[model samples]
Target: MGVFIHWAGTAALLAQLAGAAVAWGADGGADGVVAVGVEEFLGSTGDSAEQLLRLDLDRSGTLRAREDGVGGGWRLRGSSSAGRIDGALLDAQGAMVFNNHYADADLRDNVHAFADDVVTAITQGRGLAASKLAFVGSREGRRQIYVADSDGERIQQVTSDAALKGSPSLGPGGVLMAYTSWQSGFGDVVLKDLRDGRERTILSAPGTNSGAAFSLDGTRLALTMSYQGNAEIYMASVSGSRVRRLTHARSVEFSPAWGPEGNRVVFCSDAGGGPQLYVVGRQGGAAERVETGYRHNTSPEWSADGVHLAFTGRQGGGPAVVVHDLASGQNRVLLARGEEPTWAPDGRHVAAVLDGALVVVDSVTGRRRTIVRGFSEIREPSWSR
Candidate 1:
C-alpha cells in the first residue's frame, strides 16, 4: 500500500493504505490527523443519508472518510427514523464529540446539517454543505434565474421571465436574489424574495442596469447602470431607493463587487484601454487599479475572509479563473478554462462555469467536480455565505 503525507504548520500527517487523512484542530489544544470512518446507518433514509454525508465530508477538503477496512481517528454513526436523523461523532477512544438530532423536513437538509456539524467540530471552520448557489440557466432557448444547493441538489427556478436573465446574485442567507432581466425590452435589475415569491424591479433605468451584487450585510447593492449616458457603478439601498453613484469613469465601469468589510468595492473598468480590475470606496472616490497583470479581467468576487479576490482573467486566449491575494499582492490561476468565479462560504473553494457547466474547484489542490450541468447553458454563479 502507498502512503501519503501532508504537512501542516510544523507537523506532517500520514495517510495509510487507500484512505487519506487530513490534519485539523481538536478541542483542548489537541491537533492531529483525522480520518473519519462511517458505519452503515439503519432506517428508511439511512442509506442515502450516509452516502451524502461521506461525499460532503470528502468534498470539504478538510478531512477524509476512511474505507471499510481502514482504521480511522474518528467514527461517525447515524440513523434515520420518523422524519428525523440522529448523528454522533466519536473519537478513537470512543469519546463523544457531537450527538444531535436533526429534524429538517428533507433528507438532504438533515444530511447537510450533519456534515457541516462534523466539519465544524473537526476543523473549527465554516462548512459549505448548507450553502446555496444562484446562477443563470437557459431552458427552451430562454435564460432564467435558478437556485440550488451547493451540492447541485434541490434546484428550483427562481424566475419565469421568458425573455432573458443573467448575473444572478444571492444575498446573505440566500433569502433574497438579484438579477438582470430583459423582459421589459431593456436590461433592468430585478430583486426577488425567495420566501414569498414576490418580484419587483429594483433598478429600471432608461439605458441599462445590470450586474447587481448584494453587500455583505444584505442592506445595500452595487450594480452598473447607464441611465446617465455612460456605464458606471452605482450603489443603492436594498429597496431600490437612495441611489448613489460610485464610479464616474468615462471609459465605462461595471461588474461591481463589494468587499467583505463593505467599505470598498471592486469592479471592472476599461479606463486604461482594456478591461481591468479597480477598487473604489463605497462613498465614491478616486479608483485605484488592482494591478492583476492581466490585460482583461472581469466578474470579481471577494472571499469571505476579505483576503483574496477571484475573477475572470484572459489567459491563453480564453477565460480563466484567477485569485488575487490582497495582502501579498500576488495572482494565481485557479482554473485554466473557467470564468465568473464565486467563492464558497469556506473561502477555500470556488464555483465557476466550465464548458457550460457549473463546477466547484478547490483553490489549494486544484481539484474540481461538476456540481450543476445538463442545462442548455449555465453561467454567472453566486454562492451564499
Candidate 2:
C-alpha cells in the first residue's frame, strides 16, 4: 500500500496567491474587498482594447465566475486581429469578476491562455488549458508521431513518416519534439521543430540511438546511445554540440527524465539486477537506486516541482502508472491500467495510453477520464510545457 503525503510548500504558496479574493456582504454593498460586477466588462472604458490585450487584473480588475446566477464559464465572446477580445473572468463563488473588449488574431488560443490565467487567479491552480500532448499512433498504417491539445481537442499529425517512429517527447516550452524514427533504416533520434515544421537528425549513431528527453531549459538533451559499445545515457546541447557521456554502466540505460531544476535526472536501468528507476546528477556521479516495492519499474517521469517521480510499476498482474513522492519516501499508484505516463504543466494531472487510447487522470482526486479515442493504437503520450 502507498502512503499519503502532504502537499509541498510551492502548492501552499500558490493557494495563498490565488485565493486572495474579497466577496460581498449582506448589505448589497462593498465590504473589505471591492467586488467587481460584469458591468465592468461594458460601458465606457476608453482603452477597452488595451485592457483586453493586457488581461492582467491590474489593467482590467478581477471578476467572479457567476453573477445573479445568470452567466458562468468565463469565455472570450469575440475577438479580432487587432489583439482585442471580449473576455470574462469569474471568482470561486461563480460571480462575474471582470470583462473587457479585446482583439487578437488567434482568438481561440488567446481565450484559452486568458482562461488559464483566470483560473490561476481564482483557485491558485496551475493553468494547463494552453498545453499540448505529443504521442505515437499507428492510425496511418505505420507508427508516427502526433500532436493534440491537452484536452485532446485538436488532434493533428506531427510526422507523416511511413516508417517506424515512436518515443515522442516534447521539448521545453513545447516548441520542439524529439522522437526516434527508422526512416533511415536504423533507429535514429530526430528533432522536429514544432514551430515551423522543420526536421533534423540529432543522433544517427551506428547502433541503437533512441530514448531522447529535453532538459529543463531546452538547452541540453538526455538520451541513450550504443555507439560507445553499450546502450548508455549521454548529454548533448540542443545544437548537437558539446557532447558528453553521463552513464558508463554495463546495464542498459534509457528513458532519461530531467528533474525540475535540471540538476539531476531519473532513468530506467537494469544496473540493480532488473529494470528500475535510478537517479544521477547531471554533471556525473554514482547512480543511486530509487526505492520502490515493485519488482520492475520503467518509463519514469519527474514532476515539474522536482518532488515526484511517475513511472510504470509491474508486479504479478500488469503495468500501472505510479507516482513516488521524493521528499517523504512515499509512493502511490495513480492509475491501474496505463503506461508511459507524462505530467502536465500544472503537475497535478498525468496522461497515459490506456486500452490503446489517450487517458488523463487527476493525481489528487483519483479521477480518470478519456481525452482522446478512436485511434487504432496510441503510445507514449507526452504533455508539453
Candidate 3:
C-alpha cells in the first residue's frame, strides 16, 4: 500500500475541514464499508421482519412483498401483465408503506425503484440492488449508449445513432444520461432523459464536444470542448445556457468529473508534460496537478461520498483503476487491469471495462465479478447514483 499527499490549496483544505474529506486506509475491513451481498441478504433472509424486504415475482409479472425480513413468503401486494407497479413501500408487518402503478413497458425498472426503497429502509444505505449503469456498447455494429441494471441485466440500447458513442455519465437522480456521440461527423454531447425516451443535443460546436459529466445537482454539466481553438474545460447549465469556461490552458483537457459537493471539478490534462489528474474550481481558475507519480491518469470519477476519486492510471502497460482517498491523500489500485472506473451508489464497488467486458469489483475485498459481456466491446461504464 502506497500513499501520496498533494495539498489542493486553501479551497481543498476548507472542504476537508468541513467534513467532506474521505479517509483512506490499507485495511479493507473497515466498519464504514458497505457490503452489498444481494445473495447473502436476499437469499439468506432471517426470521426477522424488522430490517428485511421480501419480494416475489413470477412469469406472469405478478408481484408480492413482505417487510421486516420475514421469511414466511410474499403477500399479495400487486399484479401486472401489461402494466407495472410504479412504486411500492412496505412496513414491518407486511403492511403497505406506499405503492403506485404505471402503464409502461419498463415493469422491471418500476420494481427496481420499489426495491431500492426497501433496501434503504433496511440498511440505511444506498440501494445498490436498484441502481443502474450506462455504458457504450458496440452491439449493433456501431458504438451506442446502453443502459442496464447495476448487475448488467435488463440491458437496453438508448441510442441508435449508427455512429460512435462513449463517456456515458448518469445525472443527479439517475434519471438522465449525458454522453458523446459522433452522429454529426464531429464529437457532440447529448443528453437522454431516462424516464421518457427523449434526446437532446446539448453541445455541438464546430469543434469537438465530448466528455459530458453532470454535477451532483444535475443542474450543471462539466465537459470538454474545442470550439475556442483548443480543447478546454467548460461548465454549462443543463439547458445549455450560462456556459462558462473553466479551464483556459494551452494543453488539451478532457474527462471532467464533478466533485461530490459540485463545487470542484477533476479532469485530465497534459499540462504537466503527461496526461495527469488536475482539480479546479467549478467556476474556473488555476489547475492544481494531482501528484500521483503515475505516467498517465484519466477518466476521473468522484466517489458518491466525496471522500475518494477513481480514475485510470498505470506506470506502464495497460491502465488500471485507481482510487485516491481525499481525506488521507493516498492513492491505490482498485483493479489491476481495468479502466473507466465508475462508483456504485454505495461507493464500495466499482464498474469498469475489463477484458472487453463490464465488471464490478469490490475495492475493499478485491472481489472481481463480471456483470455482462458478449458485445464486440464495452467501455466507459457510468454507474447510476
Candidate 4:
C-alpha cells in the first residue's frame, strides 16, 4: 500500500529567503540549518514565442519496439532517424532470447496491443510505466524536475541545470518531460529524457511556448505556441519537426490539453470572454464553448475514463476543482481552492495543487492530504504514462 509522508522544516516564514538560499547554497557557505523540504521530500510561470523553437519529442518514427538485441517487451530506445526496430528479451545474462522487426508504421496502430502481446508472451502479466506519473518540482531547489512513485515517494529530480522550468507533461512511458525553461536565458521548449538527464531543444521563441500534451498514441504532441503572436494551438511532430499551427485568431488561446480519445483538445481560452473552457478537434475547427457565466474557469482535464472533466475556477468562495460529467451532465466540486488537477492514470483520484502544495483528494469522498509542500510557489503539474 502507498502512504503519504509529511516532511516539514522549523524554518519560519521570515526565513523563506533561506529556501532559495539552501536551494542555491550561497557560496556553498553558511552552516547547514534545517533547510525546508517537501513533505514528500521530493521532488512555473510564463510565456515566450518566437519562430523560435527549441526542444522536441521526435515523432518521425524516431523510435519503436526494438526487434533484435533483447526483446519481447517494447524496450526500444528513442531514435532520431528511421531504422530497423531491434530488441530482445533478456534472461540473467542479458542475452537476446527474443527478437524481431517490422516497418515502424506497420506496428504503430493499437500500441497497447503490442504491449500486451509482449507482456503475455514474456512477463506473464505486468503493466509498463503506462501507469506512471511525472512532474517538475523545486522540492530540492533550483527548478529541477523530479519523478516519483505514484503516491509521490521515491522522488528523483531528472534535471539539475538550475534554469527556471515549469509545465512538464509525461509521454508514453512517463520517462520523458516536455517543458519550458530559461536555460538559454530565453524561454524555450525542451524535452528532457529522464533516463540520463539528456535534453533536446524543441521550441524556443522570444516570449513563451508551453502546454505540451502528448497524443494518446504518444506519437504526436498538441501545444500552445505564441511565436506567431498571441498564443494559439498547434500540432508538432514529436521529434520537434513538422510544426503545424492549428488555431489562428487574435484572442488569447493556450493551455492545450489532449482528450482521452486523442483526437480532440480541450483548453482555456479568453475567446469565450473572461477565459472559459473550449474544445476543438485535433484537426482544428470552430471551437465549441463548454461553459458560460462563470467569469473564470480554466484547466479542463478529462478524467481517465473520459467520463468527467476536472478544472479549476472561482465558482464560489475561492478557486475550486470542479468535475463535469459528460454523460449525466453532472457538475461535481472535488475541492475548493485547487490548482493544477492531474488525474491519476487509473482515474481513482486526482493529484491537485491544494493550499499551494501537491495534494491528492478522493474524487468521491472529498478528503485530501498534502503530498508535497514547503516550497515558495507550486503550480502547473502534469501526470505521466
lDDT of 2: 0.72
TM-score of every candidate: 0.87, 0.78, 0.75, 0.64
Any residue pairs clashing in model 1, and if so which?
A: none
lDDT of 1 by residue, 1-385 (tens): 1233324411422332112333123311242325688888889888888888888888887767666713536789899876479999987545799899999888888888898899889888878998899998887787888899998988999888577778888888788999888989999888899989998998898898999899989999999988888999999999886689988878889899999899999999999977999999999989998988888898999998899999999944998999999888899999888999999988889999999999999887788999899899998899987
Which residues of candidate 4, in runs, are more than 4 Å off?
1-130, 139-141
User: Taking the tens digit of each residue's C-alpha lDDT, what string does model 2 give over 213-245?
Assistant: 888778788988888899898887776655678
- Worst 10 contiguous positions by lDDT, candidate 3: 56-65
lDDT of 3 by residue, 1-385 (tens): 1233344555455553332122111111244322111211211212121122233111001122322222222222434443354344443234565566544455555555555654455446566656778988886477777888776778988887567778888985678888887888888888889889798888898798888888877888999998889999999888775589999988989999888788999999998777999999977889888777789888989887888889999787888889988777798888888989998877677889988999988776666779889999888888876
User: Order of all candidates by lDDT, from best down to worst?
Assistant: 1, 2, 3, 4
Q: What is the lDDT of residue 166 in candidate 1?
A: 88
Per-residue accuracy of model 4 over 289-364 as CA lDDT, tens digit each? 7763467887778876678788887754688888888777677778777877887654546778877678877575
Stretches of candidate 1 exceeding 4 Å from the true structure: 1-33, 69-72, 91-93
RMSD of each: 7.1, 11.0, 13.6, 19.8
Q: Decide which is better by TM-score, 2 or 3.
A: 2
Better of 1 and 4 by lDDT: 1
| CA displacement after TM-score superposition, residue 344 of candidate 4 (Å) | 1.3
Q: How high is the CA lDDT of each candidate model?
A: 0.85, 0.72, 0.70, 0.60
Per-residue error at 12 for model 3, in Å?
52
